[model samples]
Target: MNLKSNYLLFLVFLMSLGCATNPFTGKQTMAIVSNDQLFPASFKQYDEFLKENKVVEGTEDAARITRVGQRIAKAAERYLNANGYEGYLKGYQWEYHLIEDKTKNAWCMPGGKIVFYTGILPVAQTDAGIAAIMGHEVAHALANHGQQRMSAAYIQQGIAIAGNVAITDDESRDLFNQYYGVGSTVGAMLPFSRSHEAEADRIGIILMAIAGYDPAVAPELWKRMESSNTPEFLSTHPSNSSRIAQLSALVANARAEAKKFGVTGFTE
Candidate 1:
């Protein structure tokens, strides 16, 4: 086989070998970097981040962040165990911290390390609101979005390499690179990321409901975020309006799902 053919075959093999099923969605997703590799790196980075930032503790808001985070984590475990994916979170060293930052952001790293920015606490006005945010962040980790993103990036790079190798003409290769970069990002990567965000939103609501937090608060929380949202096509996350609409529609379904787990009450 020619070098180009060899590269293509290797790409296919790489893709075929590095896949894992998402228990929540039951879809095979890319996992070029396994959790075994991703988690330690994530933990290290999280620790570095905490060291660089002021972590709020000994305060009610900080306590609430940890409280909500633990509840969300337990809710995820319950859902996974009930679905027969017991021990799915083994090796996950869950930690939650409230960072004193002005950025309205909160994120959960691969190994369940989470940080909530103090700036967002006002937006996440209540425990249920915090649960909404916590659930969404935890859902991203539970769904293995980080691993999938890294794997997808590898595929994108691999395809670019194959294209550059196949096209012998310098001019053609340059043009191909330009178009491929924009086309692949806009057409494939953005949509993939948006889908992950939507899936996290769906799963987040269910988790918050099961954790005894009102899933209905999810939409309200998004409403508060609407002012800062970018256009849907250009952003990694769906538009806040879109998230609000989706969460609003899913509230009843989330409550129903929680009821199956004997969770009949929700805190507002």
Candidate 2:
């Protein structure tokens, strides 16, 4: 077998071992970095971030952020327990904070540590809008998107290393770098990231609904995001227009899903 064939076989083996089933998607995803390894490190990083940043506390917005986060977490717990995923979050230590920042963003770390920037509050506007963003951020953690991203990065690196070893000519190597850089990133990686974003959106709307927040307002939050003007293909996130459309379509289904948990009369 040639070097290329050996590399191909090795990659296939790695992919097989890295696959794990995501309950939300009911599909296998890459998880080479296990929660046991990722969670502690993420928790430490989150602590360091809080220590270095101005975290708002004892205010109405900060209190709301925490309240919404707890509700979302409870919703996730209800879904997981009902779906035979009991103790799925056994190792998770959930924490939520509102950070003082002008950047319109929020994120959840690997083990349920979440932060909401103040700039996003204006876009969020109301309790339901905040729940929309909160649910999306928490969904990323619940789906283990962080571990999947790490695993994907490792795969991308391995492929690049294989190319370097198999191709001998320096000029050929330069061409390979050029094409592979664009092809692997735009063709493979960006799509992977975008899919995660969409999955988060789907899971998020459902969780918000289950938590007694109106899922219908999710599209409105994205509609507010549409002013950012980033194109879908080039960005890590799907276009705001695409997100809005998807959320609009998912609202009824999300509401129905919430009903299974005895959750009714969503609040707008």
- Best candidate per TM-score, number? 1
- Per-candidate Cα RMSD to the true structure, in Å, reads 1.0, 1.6
lDDT per model, in order?
A: 0.92, 0.92
What TM-score, over all chains together, does every model reach? 0.98, 0.95
Q: 71-179 in candidate 1: lDDT tens per residue?
A: 8999999999999999999999999999988999999999899999999989999999999999999999999999999999999999999999999999999999999
TM-score of 1: 0.98
Candidate 2 lDDT for residue 119 = 94
Candidate 2 lDDT tens digits, 1-268: 9888899789778877756679886888898889999999999999999999999999999999999999999999999999989998889999999999999999999999999999999999999999999999999999999999999998998889888888999999999999999999999999999999999999999999999999999998888874546677888988877888899999999999999999889889
Report the Cα lDDT for residue 71, model 1: 89
Judge candidate 1 at residue 60 and give its lDDT: 89
